[model samples]
Target: MSNNKRVRLSISQKIDLLDQNATGQLNQTDLGEWAMKKFNLDQPLAQQTISNILKNAETLYSNVNVVKNSKSLKTTRYPQLDDEVEKFVADMNNSNLPVNRDSILRYVRHIAQVKCRIPGKEISFSSGWLTKLFKRIGVRSRPMHGESASVDISSENIQNELRKIEELLEPYDPVDIMNFDETGLYYQQPPRRTICSESLGGLKKSKTRLTVGLLCNSDGSYKGHPVVIGQHKSPKCFKTRANLLSMTAIGKKHEVVYHYSTNAWMTNEIFTAYVKKLDVAFGRQNRRIALLLDNASVHKIKIPLNNIKLIFLPANTTSKLQALDAGIIANFKAHFRAQQYDRALCLYISKKLDNLDVYKMDQAQAMFFLANAWLKVNPETIKNCWQHTKILAFKEKTICDFEPVEYPTSALPLEEEIVAELNGMIPDLPGNFNNEVTDVSQLNLEADESDMIVCYTANTTNNEETAEG
Candidate 1:
């Protein structure tokens, strides 16, 4: 049998061929010869492929229907398989797993062999069948990446915890209710893709990063200045440059505060200083202010401060319960990336004319980008994120009610677009960049002490009155 001569036949043609061979009007050899001539095959069909089709002729005929007085062919094989495949896809989606042709084929074989009691050798899950199944099911496979797993959002315990937070917020206004979370940004890391020569298989990207703490109120009424933490206490980049202080001033204008740690980790002491600043800025001396935070070790405060309450979300539930995770952080990242792209474009143009290396991003540039990105995040986005987690419900009592809106889909340009803008400046641009900016905030869940308490005291003097959770 010549593999190259094989021709794909329509369902009606297959059914007619089966009937002709079954009735003995044409023997198998004669039918094969006739099929070769009729289909003008370049090579003969594989015997196994042909035999499988012949053996399943009746099953195919029964499963498919031919339109009356027409040559239209339609298949209705294994209707239940569609439902089973859909459920399998749904399961994969919920677990944040990737689904592809190979995975689907494996699943189908499993169903046939184990669930349907069919022998593994008897199951015929061809690539063609898989393709048709995808079309029938209206699903297209796309590249996907895995995310950190946490507690199930719909679990009873998580729901109850969220409800408790909602009730706890009833006494305070939106401005008094704030959510604080921290995430790491690889400021100087090249995008997952970079323009490089083909000789370089993959560009070595930078690991230079900074941890940023974001604070925003539930009502979207106020967004506190971002607290940026870097590795060095006073980086030479800022200390040596005469104009670097001016760049820091740009961040300050956008309400971006700077801090530093030995390892760039948000420590309890740093968090305390941040909270004290928050108290002073928000004027929490007399009013009760609620600060919602995820269960992170760095967020733990040994002693409580005045008039500020620290509420920790349920363990392993930040992905679902944290307002920052809902969408605010994502928007902030998008804006930051957009700024990076703009900088790259400017460099590309400059490098073309002046022959200067424009790929390296400095700390000052990174801070400027970060500050502007935070400012770009609109109040609507903050409010929507809080509402999304059901932590704060928007009231419709007033004529102008806060309507939850998503971050605009077109707010950030596609990576492809950015690359195109820099076309010809760099050779062999990567098809895709590693761009997996790890949301370190979600991945690092280890607590320094399990019994650590975060207390909100009435004032700096009244440290004795701490609310223990």
Candidate 2:
């Protein structure tokens, strides 16, 4: 277990040793020279016994010892990370904290090159040793629930929407289905804490888990033809019908512009105005358009618009049927993470408050950082999106032989499902599952039921083996 006993050579030493016998077929004397070069030893260290040394090394340390641990058997007077990489690593350690190895590896990999000019900081070699070290330390960083948003969807509505979506699925044309919706765009960083473990430097805010809310599509970065929509991604005067209808992603087709609108945008005026234009744009006659929408108050609040069909989301369950929640949004975030190498598209957001204790500076700087990140997100290359949405089924009351519960009468109706219906539930190609997700069983249930036992069949998955072993 004590790696200190092993001989490990620096990359430079290995390269120098390999240089002598370019063919790597050396006689005993040459082997002695190679060993001397690799270990920086005095000549004649293994002068006549080069073969014995090589054989002994192979027997004791394995064949890879010649290359893998060329810098073996050297312990520094100060046993710390490289000086250049210290800032990147900061106080990460294995104290009372998780003793997390993978977290450490992630921290190391993320900040490796950013550490310094030295390449050793780039990545870890000696997979066996790193594995051993990680096993010894263990991962302290574990992901919990998304703390900010607390939205829920019911199983009953999930089933209904599944039925509706299935019926709608009868007529197939991916290009025909158009999804629309409005989400908030807050310029903020995810909460970070100092990693508080003995082995870790405690949770510190590095550019980690940066989450942003962007209204995009299953296929493209929600392109609102900034060329046409200008600065008003949403209208300044509380979003109007014309504002929603007029908004276009410079190059996108008007008919294909079906997206969702939110009551959060507020007002029957904007909702009505937008619906009218959308009606004229995709009249039932022009091309047979079915509007999918969530049961936001406005769709029902406004005196019903004739000719425009409104698909009401099940009471208290749009999150279940909604396409974006289970589909496009997941895909976008995945793309955002996969490319987080060499500081790709991620920003270092600092929460330095102004004298008034406002996060204005953080928001301003964060938006600026996100603007550049937008360029990196092409939103074209992704897969398996909406896999979560396809098999989605929500039922209010199970018949029998399954989990039972009291449905809340006060629960907000599963109203949001229609946003996709109002816009036409859009399907994405393999590419742009950027936000595509498998149905993440948010199953947010508080213990109102003492009688219910939430158990499942013995699925017999040994996934927890990694943790236990």
Candidate 3:
């Protein structure tokens, strides 16, 4: 069978191609090779096809819509306004603020009245406009309830909580003030979007996950060993020494403490045991530290520790008040995802893997990468996240004083290298390469067990009893 395959280029890709062509850095043939590799085409793009695209480059550029990750070009009524609103919504979501129809409409009104003010002219934001805005931004209204719905995200309430945490943490040294939280890790998942045919786009995402608990000091000087929880105790990948050594060779020594539960989630028992272990460690060092915790039911401490003081943040306020939730965990996940791609690429280079279509990382492999990722998180990043919570005493700084920080993600150095190496070695890619992504704050929130399920075969259940206990 021929390895060559046909693919369709989206309007965005076409515009990007035009930009590269305009650079005059590559000839038609070379550009064809670049396009083949870039778009994951099985065969080199024909010279005539490039010429035709270049001929219609202006049309393609004009058709490119403001909607992000859109595979199709759209005719938007207000392109510039759409871009601004999308950016506003994204910033709101990234800051862990609620983004609902009311909030969006308020923003639209602000932009129309303040930013785009015109004498004797008023802009009406109709339901049709709101619907189109939501569609363009890929946002939908989801039901919110319980404590989350009742969360007082008002400025006064948030400031009061911040002041309260600041006061509680004031007496303790930065190193003695610590925050602990749990996050979900989808280790084997790929990116959510990919350059692919219509048939392959919008496929279901992988639900395989492990819960990771991270403890870090306020000063960013100390990152305690991670506590990992998974569905299985003795997974098949962990059955052999060789499998463990493979991960060790790729990353630093694995120091992660692993546990197992029925659903691989953080339970009251697991959290209490983990805390007790930390308390004992601190006691041995003669350290009396303040441990900050969220109001999760699992975070309840059944036993009192002599050396540890547990302070729980206000209900539904961890997103704004917890240091780790501010950005530390997101940065850690970025590093983890980057290492994930790095591991897959290394395997492919070693001929152990055939393609990048699907790279399955076992529990053992995930542990090593998890350790490495946590280790790679910068101390400054941790401090910055702590500052972000406004729970720490930080000097007033203007926005212009700091350059925007780029959190590490899978796309950063590895994606380009993988594409370049694969283009040279392999002529055909089996399937679309997904770049899995999700909300960083959502990872730290309590997981919905309904979406996650782990199944092991009879042969791989050897150490299940011992692991679970």
Candidate 4:
């Protein structure tokens, strides 16, 4: 008779077999017989092992406990490396430089080799290590394309300045308080992506842009017409007799006024003309008015006007303290882009139906679209923007109860659906086309040419002379 040798089962193998048998389809005797035949164990030994496994089955199934002490060499832990990386990150953030994955990896490798004195062969800063490092440091990497350099809005100096402005504004009526700012529009550029053919490599868009100045009262009761500045004194596109006549007629009908300059920028001369218009509109009113502006060179005009006061916001505080920057400009741009998208879709559909090869927009059309967008901005949006800059404090009582203004349907676009459809139809769309305009509204309450405002307390002669002069 051949001798049968018993097989020794490993702990993992034993656990696996026990787990399989734990289903309770077979009784203990049957399981023991099966183990004896399959694992080449003696009947008595199999029965004993099976009993022990069943008894300890609860502990085995409940916990994995996979980690085991090893006698082999282990990697060294560098606790100091974390502190060094944190310091490096702090220095990078403070330097106002872009911090991206590649830059971070390069920084870590440098530190590991030079600062930590780790030999090149021994140093390893894999992507996994970088990920873990970022997690431990509690920092996330993201695209911050247009974010302003960090400002200490809560600093003592900023608080004191805000307090001073608050005291200065206490006496003015909400209607008499206003924020003035300017923005630029790239009117011809459709959002980077639109319904287009995937086969096309790229689409080159027109670079034509226009600058606009916007003013609105703190209570949203009044919004000044947009003052549009364009590059051509008489654009060739508008030189046609019919086009010129149409432009003239449109200017007369709309609140938006068009101006021309070499660069389409708001110069002091153009700004002076705008202030004159503001003077005619609001300066004649008996009530004192306070206009908040940023410290832009163009806003420094010397021309004096009657019954108006200019308050220059603290330096670099425009992002935090300027009401227009808080949301008004952003809303305007969003509305403008939505209008453009609608126009493009309409034109595309019309061309397709007519079998036309192409469709394009002219300056006149862009200006009209801009005017319509300006009008579409909700009055409530303007009022809420003031709240961001604390211009309209929650505790302050207004002349009338705040009524919510209804936003037009045109201002609300189904952004996700529109974008997805556009991308599907036109895969060649530029990725960055929908980015908000980055033009800073460079405005200052102080005019370089004149004080722009005649003090309410000044002598009548001085006020009259300043206004007349």
Candidate 4 global TM-score? 0.54
* lDDT per residue (tens digit) for residues 1-469 in model 2: 7333334445344444445445668865766666766576655334434343443443434333233433443332222333322333234332212334455456555454454333763344345645544332332235532211233443565666657764664353332333444333333222234355565443233331222333333344343211111123344322333433432221224212222233224345555656676567556556444444567775654555554455555554445445555544444444333333212222333334332233122222333334334444554531123234432222212224377687867645345564445334233312113334332222233444432232211111232454477
Position 101, candidate 4: lDDT: 73
Q: Which window of ten consecutive residues has the lowest lDDT sum in model 2?
A: 223-232
After aligning candidate 3 to the native by TM-score, how far in Å is the CA of 206 from where it should be?
Answer: 2.4
lDDT of 3 by residue, 1-469 (tens): 9565655677677777888999999998998999989988878888888888888877677766545456556566556667778899789766757788878888887876676663324446778878877887677776542233235557687668766766666667778989999999988888775776565745456788999999998778999888889898777777675557355433345578788999999999988898888889999999889899998889887898988888888777887778888888888999998988887788878888766544577778778888889989898999888887766553233334588998756423336665566545432321111212122222212445442222123323544554687
Better of 1 and 2 by lDDT: 1
Alpha-carbon RMSD to native, per candidate: 27.9, 25.1, 26.6, 28.0
Residue-level lDDT for 113 in candidate 2: 43
Per-residue alpha-carbon lDDT of candidate 4 for residues 175-220, written as tens digits (9 for 90 to 100): 8898888888888664564466575454566677899888888878
Candidate number of the best TM-score: 1
Q: Which ten residues in a row have the lowest lDDT in candidate 3?
A: 430-439
Off by over 4 Å in 2: 1-140, 145-157, 188-269, 283-292, 299-309, 312-321, 326-384, 391-469
Which candidate model has the greater lDDT, 1 or 3?
3
TM-score of each: 0.59, 0.35, 0.53, 0.54
TM-score, candidate 3, is 0.53
Candidate 4: residue 138 lDDT (0-100): 61
